[model samples]
Target: MDSWVDGQPADSLSLKDRGLAYGDGLFETIAVHDGQPVLLDRHLVRLADGCLRLAIAADIQLVRQELLSYAAAMGEGVLKLILTRGDGLRGYAPDPTAPGRRILQGNPAAAYPAVNAEQGIRLFPCSTRLSHQPLLAGLKHLNRLEQVLARAEWQDSEHAEGLMLDQAGRVIEGVFSNLFLLRDGVLLTPDLKRCGVAGVMRAEILFQAESLAIPTQIADISLEQLQWADEVFVCNSVYGVWPVRAYAALSWPVGPLTRKLQTIARALLDA
Candidate 1:
């Protein structure tokens, strides 16, 4: 097992840590291939942003170096890095002088069905609606009870992922991935300014789409809008990309745009 606590060899942490007490932390799930962490810069960028947003003091460059070393040791797997506002006394207030802690864990990458990318996967519309929290929106914070509750709605593997919506009935994202769709030749992804995680792969897709000259937009898509789309897909750093063939009663055929993004996604993930 590859694990580290605060750049040391320990595998355990203090019980009073803020991360454990109040979920005051952020994490990054990175895909490793051939001794490399994919999109490392992007991941670090998001991490740094989260740290700043939460007022968590950190040395991001040092953390990046540690991540690379830890990732290479894994050879091929998933690298999970957690940063928490070090342990503090019992209270809601944080101690500004407390240095943050970094916890790293490595595990074998999951082997998803090849057909998931080849043919496609189905979606389940989760009843758990995300609350409007602009302060925490787009940040991969430790608070993930909403996603946990939504994922608990289904037990079978019939649906590879569940789609979540905001309180306003606007489609937000998949349980663990960002959502996107192709409608009338335009690529549409849900706006995460109000909720949902702004994933690294999702950012790369937007950049790649611009270079590919594929029209793209970030909008509040309703369930009806998603149903009327020509094609649908979901993405995360680890999974790269997954085409959605069906969601509830609506079905879609994998279109040309999805295929193009899939190629780019795989390349980036394997890079």
Candidate 2:
């Protein structure tokens, strides 16, 4: 693995970086295959959008070029792009003139659980609930303590994932991926207006589903409603899409619709 910090040949970043100090940064984890990044444009767009929302000055072209160079060296791996508000003084108020710093790191993608892809996954309902914060709901910001804590609540290998609920007890998403449930032939996902990282793969799935004429909705979901879902799936850019075969004691098939979506998702990535 190799890394570049602000175009410099360095392996370590300043501990005083505002990102470290105040979590004032955004990041994107991209999947690379066959010497190309899957959904590169979408990831870049989201990163740029996050910069805009946070009042950070980001050079999209430069970032893209750096990512391509890093990917070329990596061959096949996951690329992590981080943009921080740079080092700042003792106060919380940021200096409007300080230029942001960018870091691009590449590492080999971890081997995924093969059985999960074929047979499907089993999930647990985590006791930890997500806090509602509209301001940080959709951005892939550095504040991930919530997910860390939620994931720590379980150590069982059989539990492939943990389903999280919002402060209102509404089912929101998984520990590291977006959640979707199928009910009465319609697909439903939690609205990110309250809290959750708006995953790149989630956006792609929603868009492709619309194009395929699949009925989909973004709404609040209760645990009761989720328990009745015909099928369930969790998704992220790196893992693509994984069908949830069991949640608690409830089980489901890897349904035809989910298989179809997975096909499209794989094709999109491999394209």
Candidate 3:
């Protein structure tokens, strides 16, 4: 499928686009199933919040319409929506009146071994650490050099995902997913107030847990805390959830809470 730029099919972006020049933008990678974007409202909410925080003058209603149209045409696969600050002048200052640039690219559904979800996966201890940026934290922004470097730390299939930490040695998330752990029947995830992308799936799981009367917490996680967790899992909007069996010297079993949430997540992505 061809990429769409501002509701029109285009193959190239302007050279002066702020997203290209200074990574001044936000993005959302959505999952399309049966011609509809899964978790569409949540994605939109996050995108809108990002635009508001970044002070980007984006017509979110127009972006929503474009996403629906694009997903309908795509039918199935992943849709990556890139919202740039439009073409800009030769410096860091952005034009206050410039409209946001919307780009939609479609790709085939992700293919991971079934064993990853069924049996469980190992976590590669990534040496690359996330930087602290409260203003930009939790927004799926265009700047992803930290994740790029973290992902590059491993190249083998032995580890299905890599665990990332902040410079302060606080466990944050995965290279492309959110991290969660179950301990004493309570679900706990890292607090993204300081860093990390607050993933759509992570938010959904938290909400689902709350509705089901399961205890959930968002707190600063340390390596010591993760070691004692009864169960560990990683998740994203596209891949749903995968139980984590091992990380470094620590290991955990697939607990009941993890499976319960996994079933909910699976239903959401497969629905």
TM-scores, all candidates, are: 0.97, 0.96, 0.99
Clashing pairs in 3: none
lDDT of 3 by residue, 115-166 (tens): 9999889999999999999999999999999989989999999999999999
User: In what order do the candidates fall by lDDT, top score first?
Assistant: 3, 1, 2
The order of the candidates by TM-score, greatest first, is 3, 1, 2
Summarize candidate 2's per-residue lDDT along 1-271 as a digit string, tens digits. Answer: 7588987657999988999998998999999887788899889888888888887877789888888877777788888888998988897897665558999888888687888777789887888888999888889999899999999989988877898889899988999899888899898999999899899999999998899888999998988888899988888898888899987778888888788888888787676
Per residue, candidate 1 scores C-alpha lDDT tens digits across 183-218 of 998999999989999999999899899998989999
Of the candidates shown, which would achieve the greatest TM-score relative to the real structure?
A: 3
lDDT of 1 at 22: 95
Where model 2 places Cα greater than 4 Å from the true spot, the runs are none
lDDT, residue 85, candidate 1? 95
